[model samples]
Target: MLKLLFPILVMLGFAQLTPVSDFFTWDRNLILQGEVWRLITGNFTHTNLAHLIMNAAALMVFCFIFKDILNPKKLWGLLLSISLMTGGLLLLSPIQSYVGLSGVLHGLFIWAAIEDIKQQRSTGWLLLVGVVAKIAWEQYFGASASTISLINANVAIEAHLIGACCGAILQLLYYFYTLSTASDAPK
Candidate 1:
């Protein structure tokens, strides 16, 4: 968990130092201008302290749930895969610019929740139901209103959907791989 928090804390500090969010947000125009680094860095940036705090809380929730299951390698793999997939989907869509870790948090939550289900833990079903409900609510109602007007950012439902899908897909692959490996082991 420290492995994940270290970078997020660093990025939060970097975001505080950056006066212009455009420097860290995923902007289609700037990306077209070859500022491709935004694809990765944008995941770490937030609109304001409130936004950062919300994201950090969400990350902690997911990390705490998956702490025993996620080693450094699995954590890194999930982070990179989910973020890359989220970026790819954003680039193809009409989103002009975006910031915050909400999207990645959705992915992390889904991955951990599914891992719980695979282990026959009841919390998995509860988490899955909550996630599905949240996504559905977003789809029907647009972005949920944030009380933190200081941050003043719109939630990108597309990012959440893409991230969740990627996580679900990754978990499915992991499940199959585990099954195959177990079956192949000599009795």
Candidate 2:
């Protein structure tokens, strides 16, 4: 939906500007110095045109695949929440700086796929398995050489892991919450 894509497109536009990109990268020292906006902004930043294009294309693919399953608000919420959680968790790792939407993408794909399953769409199972396997493989062997070369940075595998975990957990919590709310309604 344009509502969701608008913000992503705006972030992509901002990333194309050198000054904005520099100011928004997730830098630990800068964050320690109180530039906290980087925590959220960094997820929307990118290292190069290749990185931007790759993530943007992935976003479009996800939007097309899950469009019917996820309303724009729900999809945007998953993305923002996962981005924030992943960014915060990265601070606990050895990484001092990070950027790119891949982490949030992983989370969004996961959470949306689960929602698909809740709606009884069989494709959700395929997507869930595929993303879980991808994350698992990344954990075991590191990112693909082609991806590393394309992005020109050591992929933050930890971010991917954190994002996926957060996505699963959030979906679980939401499931429980909805169930409880429904149960509490008057008979």
Candidate 3:
């Protein structure tokens, strides 16, 4: 587990050392200027120390529980899918500029929760509860609104919602795939 976490920690450390303005900048400048990579890389770059710490802590906590059941290959697939979908959604947004891992976190939580449920594990129910509560908190309490505004940060609430939806859809596809494959197996 430490081996898997080391690279992420190192990347975060490097991100911290760089000037945020150099890496965290986003806007029409990025879109029209053709710096489209910002759509994806922006999620990895935080506006400040607090933003990075909060996101990293949440990521670590979620990974601890999810890593146990999810093989590395599946985990990579899920992350890649979520990142691609998130970038696509952000590109469609009128806000023009946004950044942060909140959408990915939401996608991960949704995916983990669904995987747990499909396996009929109690942990899935707990994760579902957690994701729901997080959604409620972010929606009503505005806890995320502050960090969301740091750098042309347009909250990308739509992206987060879409990511969760995509995760759930993927879970359904995986479930049906497993079922069909099992039924087709030789007795």
Number of the predicted model whose lDDT against the real structure is largest: 2
Q: What order do you get sorting by TM-score, best first?
A: 2, 1, 3
The number of the candidate with the highest TM-score is 2
Off by over 4 Å in 1: 1-4, 19-21, 147-150, 176-187
- Candidate 3 stretches with Cα past 4 Å from truth are 17-34, 144-156, 176-187
lDDT of 1 by residue, 3-122 (tens): 766775666667655765657788888888999877766777887788888887877777777888977677777877777777667898789887877777788888888888979999
Candidate 3 local accuracy as lDDT? 0.69
Whose TM-score is higher: candidate 2's or candidate 3's?
Answer: 2
lDDT by residue for model 2 over 1-187, one digit each (tens)? 7776777777787876899989989898898899988887888889898999999999988887877766767877877788888888889989999999988888888888888898898989999999999999999999999999999999989988888888888999988999999999999
lDDT-based ranking, best first?
A: 2, 1, 3
Q: List the pairs of residues colliding in candidate 1.
A: none
TM-scores vs. true structure, each candidate = 0.85, 0.92, 0.76
